[model samples]
Target: MEENKNKVVELLKQYMSTPENEPSRGISYLKEAVFILNGQGKTLAAHEILEKELRKFHDNSTVEMAILLNMMIKLSALVGDFAGAVEYSRRAQAICEAKNERELLTKVIINTSGLYFKMKDYDKALMHANKALQMAKRNGDEINAACCLNNIAIIHENGETGESGIPYLEEAVKIKEKHGMNAELPSSYVNLAELYYESERKAEAAELLEKARTIAKANENEYAIVEAMKYEARFLKGEGDLASAINLLEEVREYHQENGNKTELLGVLNDISSVYELMGDSKEALNTFKQITELSRSIFKEEQARSIAQLESSFEAREKLREINDLAEQNKRLRTVNEEISEKNNELQEMKAKLEEINRLLEKQAETDPLTGLLNHRKMKSVLDSEISRAERYETPLTMIMLDLDDFKSINDCYGHLKGDELLAAIGKLIRSSIRKNDFAFRYGGEEFLILLPSADMQRTTEVYSRLKESLREHLEIAVSFSAGAKQWKGESSDEFISIVDKLLYEAKAKGKDRLETSEAAI
Candidate 1:
């Protein structure tokens, strides 16, 4: 390795020392140096060397220069300087267009589309990807065309079209398989598996996922292996093996965290949190949520710093241009620079807005029950505390009800878990629609629910229960009923109040199912 590094250093020096008029002569040296550095996993070092040396030959528009810029584009993207990568891509693209270099131009367009995809500008990404696909097809570049198809499918999968991109991915996979493109098969298989899973084709998803894993293992492709594991973890969770799912995700989380992959780490942490929630470990879930929030803030800060650095670089370049131009041209250049600055500012604002939106969604997801779409028990405590305080302050009537589905276990046994889940979802929807806007409902636990009705007396609470029962029978096909307990608050602790209502529910269940027992009736 030491010998290889020394040789790379020598090659870079030779490339830098080559005369400006013979830029093509230096291209071999630069390419050799890059190849060596990449083998050593020192791409950042290679990028720095090339970027510093290339400064002296800015006037050269040779194919060599375009090649160097393209290399820099890939390096910048790898280092997470997407804005810089895009700038390099634009420069290379201009040279390719001017020279009518069709092959290199297609490659540059494909790379630009990938950069835009990373930047989350899906419209521009899709546009450039399609353009590259057309060019690749026209040139009979089957491999590049297959890659373009994969990229286009990914864009559609993530974009606002609400389309799964299954068709595009299928075509890409077929082409690669026909050509025996083993190097590319793993990724295509993984992508197709994800789409199949989303489309509810679990059997196909499992087959493709296994194929992806096997091929990735054979190729020693660590990235594809990890990707396959993530989906495997998801399948495990869906199968009710929460412990196995958590174990798989913990491995993925450690890998991403060690690699400093914040985006992938966030995803792993989210999956872990979900598994913890499923296991009824709210403490661990909450801790994971805190980690996610901290990591998200860290990513946002880094992005802001990168944007500021780019703006500073842009300012320096414009200053240099102003120094060379006449007064009139300088004025025109300043106007252009101001416009660019405005656009960048707008972009920053948009990024901030997006980050805020993501945080909002994360908070919502943490509080929500995934199966029933109701507030989960983790969110219930805080809401109950707040409502209790409000009721005390305003001297308003407050009531609580506990409802448990009658023979829910039998339902799960008679009709598989999927049918049980569907029934639960239907019941949750009915409960939500039956309650007043001011009332709060929660999926307290398996086969159980809790409703808090503020400013409602015992009679009103009973009426709400009656309405829910009626709605369930009217809306559901299967015969379903619940035993419920209702009570008006008597200035007791929240826990004590809940316990009393729970006992009342048991009393109703003891007497007969599908009935409501109220404090007023007992009195």
Candidate 2:
């Protein structure tokens, strides 16, 4: 490593002096130097090196688009420049999209989605992660899929949305193990350990952290090694080993200092301060806090200087231009303002566009039943109308299932609306969990949700309906039961198709409320 570093520096010095080496040797030397700096934990210096290289070779073919963008991603992430990271990821994504590089696209999406996560925008994170997951599966890129799953798990965990993330993390771990990705296992273990910790499984967390530490040390992964040490220090602190924790934190700080990881070193300083405070070493704690304050003040002053320079530049630009011209120019400006006012008046007369948009979205949402969060009658009709046309045009099988909660009104009357709503939501969750990619559920009417399964034959539809029924029976403890009436697509209008299932649904409700019924033939 020392030899490689010396050779890289020599190449950089050589390339800097010669114009001919600018494209090849210069870029190569810069890349190698950047890697070496990163290994030495000089992240900011490494970032500066890459930035200069990028500027020098703005359109050089020697530097691949993917490589440049990836460097940007890493540097921006290290500097906490999330917006810049997102922008670079977008550029990478556009290139990937143009080339149909699905795997690379997935990776870019994951990186972009991480920006949303850092900003505490879970919905957007989930959206991008899910999209990446779909694309990864389509491209059969298991590594990308695993990465997507892990990211989704992180979002879910942070959002505290039950245990939805557990399965995703578990699947990612399984994939990593199967693929012999030993280097990635430490991160997976750390994430899994966090999950176990949140789930109140301290023993499991401890065991996983131990495994993580072992692998990290064996691999000489400094970042993961610091994380493991931090985790162990935390564990010791929790166990009331204050002195031991302090010793570990100090040792870790020394390790990071040797590794040139200033950020981690500062973090360890903070940890040591906390431990000292807990141990009644007020002088040591105060000194540590003072150091942190000094660093913070230095950063703030740098930012203030930057802001002042930007303000001066803006002032110069303003001074270079005329604010207002002669009387004729002022008159012309007044006329233009009058014209804009007239346009605004005309727009106001047309409609309250923002209010109208909000109303339209609300109306669409209202067509969803509140309890089950499925489409109500109006929306279901709209969907059925579209699906009917699609089925006929493509000559593909489209199945409809009209599911009614049996004795639902009685249950609502007996258990009251709260438990009734719970039952409905639980069933809705079940349907959402059970459906295929092409299938959807909509609350057709009171206590009735309609399921639309495109490209499903009679047998497949029947099997799905059966599984749904069984799932509800096994999962729901409430007195509510569901009866479903199913039908395959025929050359019929939307209303006629729905009537067929409705008739069968009534038949099931009349005979018994917990059974399935289907049309023998299409209309």
Candidate 3:
């Protein structure tokens, strides 16, 4: 015991000697001191030391101060100093309220509720417990809500009523069960089981205790398992099952021994001895009682050491939980960053689509005549060359048609340039539609238009020219007409055919306007 005490003191000195950065660091280290001193059955000393150390903090560290004060409240109550505990709790509550720290205030309310319960002030206890329950519910903290319900149940359990506490305990257990809170299941089950046992509901009590035992076993909760087993044996003993009760206690005894739970083993041995006495086995009962007496002296030291081990184990779990929470926060921030990047990518894609559409319009403008919206000389000349090559390769019959508006320059001199441009655009659209689907048309020069008609003889070429002259008179509502020249290809290259067609057009114009001139092939 002295050696253990020295080690705890050494840790305390190390903590105090270290430079404090965050207030939580100092509070966490001091929690170790409080746990050690409380386990050593020195609650009063723990309270004195914690009170003195906490007072040294400046007023700025309210959260740390409030937490340390709440710890002091629990220790003071442990040593039967209810007045001191109440004072500490009030001070802590004021700090929490001043800072509007609702989460911390919920814990403070729970502690204050317990303090009030210890002081036998049931009204204050119920008030604070209910407030804590509401706050926990609002915060979505299921564990703290269960704790609040359990506090409310404990407050009712101390009353003279028979089963007033049962409903609250059941509610706490229901929340724990619904949320899969295995850690809180065993104690809540035991509390409700005790109520049922007192009311002579033996079956229900046994069932509850059995459930608690199964859950504890599945969770690997050694402490919860022992507690459940102890209650179950008592339940069985009350129902006149002494043999089974002794058997169960012996199982518990072995579990305690194997797990180094000497403190629980002492209780189990006592229970076993009691069952033996009830069975009228006087010699065995006496022997077991002797074993318990011999074990009692060492239990104080062993119990303290075991408590320190439990605190250390609990601390490790808390540290693991803290690390998990930190990782979750980082993941949340990363997701936000990824979403922002995705939004920027979408915006860039929209801008890129707009740029591509602009480039397409610019390319179209480069290939077309701006005034007439027709393929100009450069572009349609390529089309004429391609068709001439195809006609020669396939030995297919093709024709060329050249049309010119009769007296076009005289009309342009008579009208303005805008009217001449309109006339040219009108003629351009007419020629494009007048040609066959496989034919190609071009604005060859100032007032001349060229059409390359594939698989067309002279008769087909004359028909297409007549269609254009009629369309012109209909849509333009003018007396303008075309002097047309049509020719069948007789193995002539594209340039020679175009020259022959233009000369024929001039002959038609010289003969008379509104005439068609064709080669001997047409005749």
Candidate 4:
């Protein structure tokens, strides 16, 4: 214990001493000191140092401010002070916005998006992501754009339609390629590949993911390299190579911890839990799951508690807004009751109209996919459900086809992640091209894609799938293949129907890995 204490002290001194050599090192040292102290079970001491250091600088330096803000948010979130983390993140975002700091603004937005995501506020998360993406585009920041795309894609993957998210990510890849920014390519490629896989385009997904791994190794971004390894593990799992997948995840976990990336370390632990689950080691899986739950709780509980104070402050602000709105309404009502105030009443009416218009815009924003400017998952599903009803009522045909990629991982591995992303974007374009005016395609999850064809029978569905498969192969000019499962719904529950098709997709993978399977009700 004495030896451990001495080592930690020495590390802190060494970290702090860097400022003497490089003046810009102070903030890094302060941030790392807190992280180190926290890891050493000195939570209170870490908090004290962080608070003191943050106060000393007032967060003026760009690098220091970003670091400080991230640390503050992380520590706050860890303690279950979500509201405080959000507030600090908002403050950081405001500062970036006020100063017209495009790069900083993107970083702050990413953090804000992350916080909202954890809260399951997908609407707010996408809002911030859209803001960041807009900033990236305006500034021509490809890396930032790619990061935003991946995050937005994750949202779509979770919401309902991963297909809707693909276009945004594809665009992001194009931007990365245009700029030759290779560092961020791996994760982006992996994301696109996952979408393809989920779409039952296993072959395309595998090809793209392989490309990501190769690129990571070539760039020697150790962190990204390890991440690619993790992705590879996931791909292997889908390929039924469970043992290899488990081994890869374990290796990644060890490497991440060795490198002291504790945040990633936590992810590795969670991933290990998943691998155990996959292996059917129920006991190990449960224990690992418990560990992750505890870790997450430990990280967020305090932050959530701290955020309560911030939440109260926000509630007060909201209440003030409500009061103002009420007064406006009352004044309008009084004006309507009287007649001499014609022009004033007219102006008030215009203001009210404007507010209504604003509300309408907000509603549209909530239901739409901000990245691709398309209908979001919830909206799409509602439309699809209605369409299904319409088709059934009329006795017309309705078919949904699941699309996925083939051997996409190899692209990420070979040409680099950026190139791999370029490929995905190109592929997304091809998929979109294959759709007719009446057809719709959505990102189902990860690399899995979905296409809905209304008033189409099984024969028509098969014809469209064949054409689409050929179109993608020719246009993408890659060994691209989609393992699709198509079904024409009968009198079965939509969930059951979708599951039947989804299972058929798995069967397709089992048969030859890059073929399509169609199943209809036995009737």
Off by over 4 Å in 4: 1-52, 59-85, 138-143, 161-163, 255-271, 302-523
Which TM-score value belongs to model 4?
Answer: 0.52
**Candidate lDDT (C-alpha), each:** 0.81, 0.73, 0.76, 0.69
TM-score of each: 0.56, 0.53, 0.41, 0.52
lDDT of 1 by residue, 427-505 (tens): 9898998775456899999989999987677877878888898889888987888998888888889898888899889
Pick by TM-score: 2 or 3, better one: 2
In model 3, the runs with Cα more than 4 Å from the true position are: 1-14, 20-24, 32-52, 55-61, 160-163, 211-230, 233-237, 240-523
lDDT of 4 by residue, 298-338 (tens): 65665565556545546577897687677876687675655
User: Per-residue lDDT of 57-105 in model 2, one digit per residue for the tens?
Assistant: 5445332465556666756554444555665676777677677766766
TM-score (C-alpha, index-matched) for candidate 1: 0.56
- Which structure among the candidates has the greatest lDDT? 1
Mark the 10 consecutive residues where model 3 has the least summed lDDT. 158-167
Q: What are the C-alpha RMSDs, in order, of all predicted structures?
A: 16.1, 13.0, 39.7, 16.8
lDDT of model 4 at position 499 = 78
* Candidate achieving higher TM-score, 1 or 2: 1
The total number of steric clashes, by the backbone 3 Å criterion, in model 3 comes to 0
Question: Which wins on TM-score, candidate 1 or candidate 4?
Answer: 1
| Error of model 2, residue 234, in angstroms | 2.3
User: By summed lDDT, which 10 consecutive residues of candidate 2 come out lowest?
Assistant: 58-67
